[model samples]
Target chain A: MNHLLNIVRKELKELMTIGSFVSVLIMMFVFMGAGSMMGDQGESITSPSDIGFINGDGGLWADRTEEFLISIYVDTYGISEEEARGFVKVMDIPLDDGAAIVEGMRSLGLDAAIAVGPGYSSNLDNGIRAVISEYYIFTNPGLLGSAGSSITSLMIGEISDRISQALVSEIADPDLTPFLLSPIKGTDAHTYIDGELHSGVRPLDISMGVMNQTLMVPVVIMMVIMMIGSIVISSMGNEKENKTLETLLTMPVGRTVIVTGKILSAAIMGLVYGIMYMVGMMFYSKGMTDIGGLGGSSPADLGLALGPVDWLIVGTMVFLAIFCALGLCMILGAFAKNYKAAQTMTVPISVLAIIPMLLNMFASWGSLPTAIQIPLFIIPFTHPMMVMQNLMFGNTAVVLAGMAYLALFAMLTIFITVKVYKSDILLTGIGQTKLAKAFAGKRIR
Target chain B: MDALTVEDVHKVYGDREAVKGIDFSVRTGEIFGLIGPNGAGKTSTLRMMSTLLRITSGRITVCGHDVATESDEVRKIISYLPEDAGAYKDLTGRAYLKFMAGFFADGAEAEKMVAYGMEMADLGDRIDSKVDTYSKGMMRRLLIARAIMPAPKVAIMDEVTSGLDVINAFEIRKIIRKISEQGVTVIISSHNMFEVDMLCDRVAMINDGRTVLCGTPGELKERFNASNLEEVFVKAVKG
Candidate 1:
């Protein structure tokens, strides 16, 4: 029992390194950042949405429709009457042009606009259906950007019900008004995406469906990259810690062959892991869709489905990304002196994989600012995560470009890894690096 | 012709030099020893000769192939066993031997090498057990077998019997003598002067990265006016 305790104590001391501690801390920060972003989006989902109301029909029913819109803010959001009145802005503008209505909504800082057409009140009073148009201005494209459109659609549905209830209560014959209770008819929603108007489609539904399909790609990519990267690094660490590296290095093999062999083995393992995760994700995504009622619009209907050739391109991109990750890990592993240090070495690769995953999840690549885009593009892992979405949207040029960049990046990493394998750094570690020397306040001779 | 030649070799790590202009030669089938205190650059010298490290200056050749320019050729003819060498813990002793033998030969010849390694290790039925389960002495025997199993032209071993009991150390010494008799040139480094005297045909005493003495055990003792190699090492290193 004492010998067992002694061995346990020794193992604990060996495993608990400062590098491991720092890596955990870094992971904590990444989770916190993601949580903060999600919290912001959550706020957007629950809060009262701002919308512009244009009354083209100068009648009592149009006035009542506008009032019902404000009532949504008061009852649902728990806001005071005065604040609710201000939440729905009544615009005295002509609703003849669709583009002008969208422009008016944007200028008023509203994501959606409701335009009541001419004869709306008269038609409804006569028991004929009154048509109302909902204009959704999509300034951003992602899961986060779709929140406003979702809220606006929910609010519009509630107002239509409230106006119908008012009409039914005032009817002389209650039995006659039963069929006409739902007099308000909403035309197909108009969505302005990237300044181009897409008629008869809701941006929210399109984004939600696209999110469900492409979401798993980035998540699976991140997991596979981190897992395989850790394996390659730990393999090098084990070789060094076991004192087997010296013997292996002295063997009759070229350094390139050694580096390539390690990468290929790790890449094969990564592909196996990726396939398993993808199969699991497929079931998981199906479960989520069923439980959350997230059926939304089908991507095929929105012209965003991937064909056979697109899938092949995505597969190639994924393969290249894995190759790049293995090569990068091989270079980092060269600096690891032991297994403990190798665990820490995985943190940088983790950060790289995670940054792209989070960004791709929250924002569309085309919608991101160039400042963020350039740096994200430079990370080799980002290409695979973005490829599925790009291919879905028929951005074949962008997908091909990403594939080319990934191929270039993979080759560059392999070249560097081979050099590191040939160098003494594999044995001597960071002690000989100029960065280490600089930190030690020593000049290189 | 010399089996190995290290001509004025130097090893530098950034601002510090580990081995400074050390020169030596070994004849075919000779069991040469590099004797030094801790951190005396003995391992660095041997590592450079085995093509595991780059020479900052000068040249080392194994069977007339330059270690720097012809490292691939040098690796083909040499094997290195570090002081604290370990086999893959997950592999059985026989599996580990087979893995190393695969690198040097294939098919029936590789099978023959594995058989020879099993004989050299002499672990009996224990050779089928995982390496991690082996005792320190047993592990040392297995590693020594792995180093010589390839039948390379030169074998470099650092501290071959380090951290072993009296019986284990003596057995390993006998194995070293047997290997040398098989016409394999061996280079070894150790702090145990008595073991060096018994196992080595020639010895070099190094201190502060320089070769301070080089001769047979008897010649070194006589030159330093000492009774044994230990006394000679102390006299030579101190002087």
Candidate 2:
């Protein structure tokens, strides 16, 4: 134990002396800044709020539909017609004058505005007269036609007919009205499909949040494992390359002890990186609030929201991630002929560890079928983010399952890697073991 | 009793026999030098003797401990310094020494041992500095100091002075002699013929996985009618 500790101490010292220990942290910080600014944040539409409302009106549904149309814009979509008119920014604005709006629609190749005309509700009530209109002054006839349905069609029939009746009572010959509305029938009929303010599934927000923490664990774990594996394998390889390993082997210290000592040293270095990364991330989370669109919660809120179950999930994933990384790195390290080769080999393993993280971070929930989820859940990396998601939305079973899976994988991976490391001490260059080669390929590219 | 012994040790690398059943022993309190040309199986023999490599056949014992079965015992009894020594660059020299000291925690009086090691290396205040800052000579000194500081029953050095300047080499030789005087057995492998001639009590010449000659330098010299150990080696190899 003392001998192993000595090796670890030595490895840690070497890691500190070289600056590679701090490099990943810097990379993560830069990745965070750049990633946040990449999509929808950097170069986007100038106006923060430009809700486009396409008007499609049938001639018979005109007056009542116009009044209903104006009311639905205010009440259903939760945006007042008054606010919509005033909200248009004229600076480089495309929709100011009627001609420009028309030209803009033409350039976009839209045949007509998307409109819910009057009397559309009455037709639906009759079960025969569908609200139909002749779309013109446009090139692309398909534009806005597919997306537009009478507000009456959107709501339940009972509510739709009542709203149509109310709109009809307000005007005579509603057929000539320009703007039309299909009455919002139900109490909860407000469904904003394309509106920006609605909080549906913001993948970017979840991804940024999940990735911030998710990518962090694996990156740190892989780096730590690589750190240790590098030290052990490189130290041995250095000995062999310089013909010194042969000498050490001849010493009274025997192959096992010497190998153990070297491995211990590597493990120790990896642990240091792990600790450094964890602590660094802990510090990093303090500043995470500076970047928005990453789940509108503070790190503190995230921490408070997570319970013991969440920790188990995180812990399991972290353990498994480290286990897999350490084992694979050790195997890679053993095959490397020199320090440079060992380091080169680490790049691929690092990337492989991160693949799971990327998959977990960016994949939309319910999008992956159960068949995919079963295997994906088996990968320890999926657990942390999965658990994070569960915790955020108050899901218990997923958190527990993710934790269990992580634990299983972590134990299995670490055990196997250790076995490979022990067997490959004297073996130089890439060996003939199919499993090792396959894993190496996964790590390298 | 022999301080170190290798009995009919053979090391086979796949099908190639690196060390083909070689045998030798070193006495207590003496400097034993194993000299050989490049790829002469010197390293293989030294490795088997040191317990770093397993013997394909036969046995090796250090201070009465078997190399294979009693490896931990062998480790405790001897310190082996390979020709290419590396220091942990991440640690301060003092911390590194302390860490090495901790290896023999129960037996090693760490504080005193580390201090003596630092003082012997002549590092002064630089002992507190990280080893990455050390020069080649400094690193060599530190490694030598680390190996000898534990005061093992046997010391195995592989090309210990290869990178040293004359001054540092002389200084290390002085330290080796000092260590030997204290009854520690010293076994070394080197290409420097003069060093072997000057320091070894007995010399073994190896070539192509076998020991061609083994005797006191003077005995070999007298037998070969040569002036020095180098000429003796030349004559032995040639014949």
List DockQ for all candidates. 0.64, 0.24
lDDT of 1 by residue, B49-110 (tens): 98888889998999999999999999999989998899999999999999999888999999
Residue B129 of model 2: what lDDT? 91
lDDT by residue (tens digit), candidate 1, A1-445: 6999999888877666555666688888877966776676677768776778899999998998888888888999999989998888887778767777777877888778887888989987887778778888765367776767767777777877887777777776666575456676776588775456677767777777788888898999999999998989998999999989888888898888888888898888999999999999999988877875576666776666788988888899999999999989999998888997787789989998998899788777776667767888899988899887777665667777788999999999999998887888888987775776665223222
Worst 10 residues of 2 chain A by lDDT: A138-147
Which candidate achieves the best TM-score against the true structure? Answer: 1
- Model 2 CA deviation exceeding 4 Å by range: A1-306, A364-379, A390-445, B106-108
lDDT tens digits, residues A202-293, model 2? 22322344445544665565556556655655665565565445434433433445545554555566667778888988677646746565
- Looking at model 2, give its docking quality level: acceptable
Clashes of 1: 0
